[model samples]
Target: MKLQSTLVFSNELPPVKKLGEEILLIYDQILAQKSPSFGKWAKGISLKYPVKAGEHLKDIEQFPRHIKAITKLTEQTSVKKLTVVVVGGGSVGDFGGFVASILKRGVRLINIPSTWLAAIDSAHGGKTALNVGGAKNQIGTFYPADQIIMVRTVLMAQPEARAFEGFGELIKISLIEGGKLWSSLAKEKQINSKTLWKYLEAAVHAKYKVVAKDPHEKKGIRHVLNLGHTIGHVLESHYELPHGIAINYGLNFALRFSVQKKVMKPAEASRLFGEPVMGFLLSPLRDDLISVKSSDLAEYRRLLLSDKKKTKAATLRFVFVKKPGKTVIQEVTVDDLLIELCRQREEELHG
Candidate 1:
């Protein structure tokens, strides 16, 4: 269960958590060293650190409120041929990438992700999204970053909750891309910066396998990565849960549901989510289950209708489970789907 240091380059960058407010200056140093390598890729780079730090980590829902402030701060600076901007975390990257994508028809993006959630999952993916009204990530564009620089230092400063929040996404990745790597992580006692960086590489490779094969999500291959995201997104929109936490809960619920449907065996589901790893156990039960009735289902349907993944036909496409490392994208009716959601609510209450 011991993660290897050889698989990860420990000296590439300092730990991000320890940097704090000096992150901007630290990044300036990184840019100075890489100036030659990024010569053609970027004209100039700048860090727009948040003045009034938001309550939690940056999120897409808070974009509009801060966009004007952000715009004012960076507006006076002369435009470089290629401007590379660094944002704090996932939401920052999402909105930052979206803005960069549309600025003067598009500009280069260089992300320096700070959170474990951002480092391991959201930051690398080409997807950028923002919330609109009551739905989650209702507005977004598909845009890729020019480069993403990961410094292990950030993980050290990350709160324990966020570290575990990121761990949830990592666990999901392991379930899909299972091997000795996954098993080792599932049993690790102390997940250190070195171990986090090690799996970050593996998770990226695993995700790349799916995204490369189906970059646009037109094929069902990439959709499998959304295994728990279906119910997960709805929960996020309805409750005020953080994105990663909501997804963790959704993943647990989906896994349990899959067992109920006989789509996967209990033993297999248990192994991936059975025991707690680093005090972050993905339980098969929900503590605060909220039931949505037939009327509430209508509202839920409205949110689904507005989902970015929807098409003109507007059918609910589920990234449901078939087995470990195997998933199927099935289109389900809203009514039928709500029934399943209600069942999940009931299960959460009794269990």
Candidate 2:
């Protein structure tokens, strides 16, 4: 499956005049306060929906009202000519993409990701998602966008701290693709917007290569993309950490687990950990974030079971790193995962 979206890199947001005459701009409401120029530009759109960006926006219960409002908003326009332009981070992209996929049995969708995380990962995958009963991505579709516009100005405009959140996904794809992407990235000492921009295109193309093999995820080739996401999602929901930050910790967990299981050689694991770029993966808040108490075990079990990748009643497909560019998937029971979680946490405290 070839990547269908046209990928374009630009210094600034595409001019509104070029977005076509009939466009419905669905953007994050926060952009108005965060980026004045973007606010001004969005004001030019005749039909626009400004949304609060986060997990709440993707709630399935609320989707009915949202879809109803959007349907009424664009009732006058011809669906053939109408284009839904989604502008924001992952959550907004998920919500907007889902809308475009179902709105009038599908419409032209263009993604203008506003955050580094969105620009680097979520915005490209064409996976639109929503939550059900507090579970993440329980309902979603593989709706690829017609165009994905990556604006340097928009991504750079984010707060410097936001770069760390994006770094997790950047490192993830680099590890999954390895070779030149990992070799060059491993040498970098600093991680900032410039670092992210330098390798944005490479990281995106690497993800496309994975997605192309398993466009709809039927063959499980794309499961590798969830390399760090298994436990990442658990932490994200448990502590409400940003998706990228949680994934960083999850990647660390997976690497450690790989060594414990004898999947990755200890020498290679140590070498990977010793790299300058790998230093950024060590979050100072690691203890506070992952120090799972016995009482928390029940909740963690619940979250793990709720995971979409579950292969059995109590088991899920876990992605383990054998080395850069190669991953191994194995099914492990929930108890096995919780035990590892405890072991890793104890090691962090004492080892």
Model 2, stretches more than 4 Å misplaced?
A: 1-3, 283-288, 307-313
Per-prediction TM-score: 0.70, 0.93
Residue pairs clashing, model 1: 15-152, 15-153, 15-154, 16-153, 16-154, 17-153, 17-154, 17-157
Best by the lDDT measure: 2
Candidate 2 lDDT over residue span 1-351, tens digit each: 224688999988898888776999999998888887888888789899989998899999999999999999999999789999999999999999999999999988999999988988999878999999987799998899989999888788799999989999999999999999999999999999999999999999999999888788889898899988888888888888888989998898888889998889999899988899988885423556665777787777878876345543577888998989888999878888888887877777777
Clashing pairs in 2: none
Q: Which candidate is the best by TM-score?
A: 2
Which lDDT tens digits does candidate 1 get at residues 1-351?
011111232333433432232112112223323334333222322444342222222355565565665455556544444454554567667766676666546655656666777777777657777665544466677776756666565445555656666767886787677675567777777655556767887887777767777665676677778867776777677666676777777677666667766777777766655545524644423554545666667666766665445543556666656555676566766655667777777766775
Q: Which stretches of candidate 1 lie over 4 Å from their true place?
A: 1-81, 130-140, 189-198, 266-286, 289-315, 344-351
- Quote model 1's TM-score: 0.70
The Cα error of candidate 2 at residue 201, in Å, is 0.8
lDDT against the true structure, each candidate: 0.60, 0.88
